[model samples]
Target: MRRKILLLDTGREWGGGTNSMLELLKRIDRQKFAVTCCFYNNYSRGNSETIESILNSIGIPVIFIPQRRQPMWAKLSKELLRTLFFFNRSLKKEMIARVDEIWRVLPNAKAISSIMRAGQYNALYMNNQPSTNVEGYCAVNNLDVALIQHCRIEPQLNAALVKRVNERVDAVIAVSHGVNQSLRQSGVDAQRCFTVSNAIDIHQTLPDRAEVRERLGYAPETFIFGSIGSLITRKANHHIFQALGQFKRAHPEAKWKMVVVGSGPEQEKLAQLAGTEMIESHIVFTGFQNNPLDYLAAFDVFILASRSEGLPRVVLEAMLVKTAVIGSNVVGTAELINHNETGLIFEYGDIDRLSGYLMTLWQDATLRQRLIEAAELRVREQYAIENYVSGVEMILEKCIERRTHV
Candidate 1:
């Protein structure tokens, strides 16, 4: 019989992790494993296709948890608590998080448990970090389903949460070795942790670079530097702005522009920083594009200045598209970009060094071409979608086998 697996995702917005998960689901071995996906939200953004619609198009079953509206009294109580603890920020934040856990997460856990039981799933596959999927771990506590967590980021877990994960989760899949090391530091058993680097479909077609650049109002000769991902503090896009500002001041004769693709809470702050840096006219913010690959292909260089990552899928996509990459020396990124070979790496928050590398790539076409060539070859040889799927399949089979023995 096919090993039945229920995949759960709790994100309200679609992200790189979700994109990677969709890729995996589309190509996973269907004859060996029957998979059902359950999402906490529809991930609706304006007129974009929802996650449910996308999955339905591919013949995969999707279940959405009914959105529960909090009562007015509950909202008022939370506000009152915030007002009462206004003086102590840490206490206030902790209190709010606890209240959210009680009012939101625990109820969701009950709902998740019901879905697991009704479906008679043999394994529960969580598509995010352990901290976010606390309910997934909780839902499988007393059930027979083997629990598996796909940690896509360096998790932020407190001692209590770490204990809960170690006690309940059957296995954990880290997207990179750095992430696997993080799991070990958080007290997750080494035997139960596996590192499966994220991958992409290398053969996917992309829009012509010239056409994409024209549509975005960029001239063919424009030296475009691009970054794609949520505009969050963790992504550290402001650092990119700082680096660009410094680079521009040093090389006033160079004609260049920075294109930031994707939207998040930090958009306003980033815009203000751009204006302050006097590069506002040289920067373009394409809020959120459904087909970022076109933009990726159009870029002369791709930059990722994230504080952390779970093997950034964007870097892999950038490499696959033959775009030269400059990324922060974080776990997942370091594995992909060898200092001067596949791509350049900068220490996180080092604006001066980042500016120098950006200048180097912009000035030296030969060096940029060499990096992209090596990056593309590396991605094609090692990070294919087939290899990623097989690795996860092997892990799933082992989880099921262990469950049977237990």
Candidate 2:
């Protein structure tokens, strides 16, 4: 019999994690396992429901848990309770806060859990980051079912939470070695964890560079630098403009333009910094592209300056499109790029070094082509979707085998 798996997600929007999960849901061997996905009906933004829709279309039923549709009173009450918990040092108040959370979440968790039990799900898989979301309580409380979690971020090194997740979940899958290292550093058992890199679906046909440049109002000769990510502080978008500013000042005669894609709360701050750096004219901000991959061909070099990441899907996409990628030497980014080989990596906070690398890649066409060729080869061999899904399947099968035997 095909084992039934209950998958849960608490994300409010689409991202690398959600996109990767969508790929897995679509490709996992249905003959070996059946999947039912449950997602919170939270304030999901553009294309956030892409996964839910795809899952439904593939004969996989998606159920939205109505836990996010809280009443105004309940919302206010929780805020007040959290505020009270923050200020009160008393043990009684902490206990009260715990009681309050349990009171609010238990009934809903019970409802979700009841559905899982009725369905006879062999395992509960969590994508709604276990440490922050309350969606797992119901499933975790059911001792008969296997609980598995995919930890995709370098969570703040919380020993207790790490220990709890390790103890409860039958398996914990990390998206990269960086995340796995993080879990182990936090005292999670290495034996219980696995590392799986996110895979990307490469678009077979790309628009000609000349055509793309013309439509976007760029000259064919103009050197294009592209950075696609949320314009948030953690993304360190300001660093892109900062590094470009220095790079531009040194290469005054070079005809170049940078396209900044994606939007967030830090838009105005980034705009101000662009102006302050006097590189505003050379920068183009395309906010919140639903299909950022469509614009990848226009970039000679792609940049990822995030303060952190979990095997970013964009870097892979950029490489597949044959664009030279330069990434900040942070967790997942560092793991993706081999300095001066597949791609270039610079110290996270060092704008000057980034500028230097950017200039070197930008000036040397032969080197850029070499890096792009190398990156595309490496990504296809190592980060393809089939390998990723197979890895997931192996882990699920192992977990099921262990649970049934015990």
Candidate 3:
């Protein structure tokens, strides 16, 4: 009989961890596993094309906990607090976080736990580390169900929450080794942590790159570069624009452009910066792609300039499509880029250095091909979707086994 699993996500809107859940739901063997997903509708930005809709189409019943979306003022206020946490990873953030949890998160957890307790699931999977994680942990406590935390990002929560998660969760699945390390630093036991790099459905077909570029009105022969991420401070997507501004000043006649393939809070400021730099025509922001990887083939070089990351799925997708890659030397990114072997690496905020790397990749076809081929080979060999599914399958079984023994 298939083991029934209940999956929960923190955000109403979709992000990498939600996308990862979609990927897993699409590929997991139904004969061995059955999944039902739960998300907060109150906080979610409802769209026709969404992870919830996609899951529903695939026969997974989605349960929406009607959460009132936090008002814009409250959201911004929380982000301000988080920004302070980001700039200074201090101990006091724990107190602030504990307050957030006590007032905001625990109430939501109690609400969700009521719905979850009535469900017929054998295990609970926390799809993210933010809001729903606490809910999942609280929901599954004393329920005799397996609690598996599939952490895709670093520790951004309070120490109290981490301690609670550490005590409650039976297994910790880290998307990258960097995320695994971050969890440990935040008090997760090393024995509970396992690294499972994000993978793509390699066999899935994508839109033809040439066709996509033509449809978007790009000149066929122009060299194009792109990155897919949120326009947030942590992503440092603004740096890509700054680097491109430098690239344009150095090579004004070059027939190259950039594509930013996600939307976030910093779009307005980034757009204004583009206008100021006179490179507005050199950049395109395609908001919220349903299958952004389909257009990966359109990029000659794909880069991520994030100050922080959890094994970027887009990096793997870019490699799968054979786009030459560049990443910042952060934990998740550095684990994949072997310093000019798999792909190039750059310092987090060095626009000039990033601009130089971009120029080098654009200028030399030999080097570009070398990096692309190596990246593609590495992904195919180590990070195929089938292997990832198998790894997850094993983890699920282990969690079940642990529950039985307990």
User: Each model's TM-score, in the order given?
Assistant: 0.93, 0.88, 0.89
**TM-score: model 2 vs. ground truth:** 0.88
Instruction: In angstroms, give how far residue 57 of model 1 lies from its true place.
Output: 0.6
**What's the ranking of the predictions by TM-score, best on top?**
1, 3, 2
Worst 10 contiguous positions by lDDT, candidate 2: 91-100
lDDT scores for all predictions? 0.89, 0.80, 0.80
For model 3, give the 10-residue run with minimal summed lDDT.
41-50
lDDT by residue for model 3 (231-266), tens? 788888778888888889999989987888888899
Model 1 TM-score, all chains together? 0.93
Top of the candidates by lDDT:
1
RMSD of each: 2.3, 3.3, 3.6
Query: Candidate 1 — number of clashing residue pairs?
Result: 0
lDDT of candidate 1 over 121-193, digit per residue (tens): 9999999898889889878888987889999998887777888887878789999999999889988888889
Whichever of 2 and 3 has more TM-score, that candidate is 3
Kindly report which residue stretches of model 2 are placed more than 4 angstroms away from their true locations once superposed. Answer: 42-50, 69-100, 103-108, 202-207
Candidate 3 backbone overlaps, count: 3
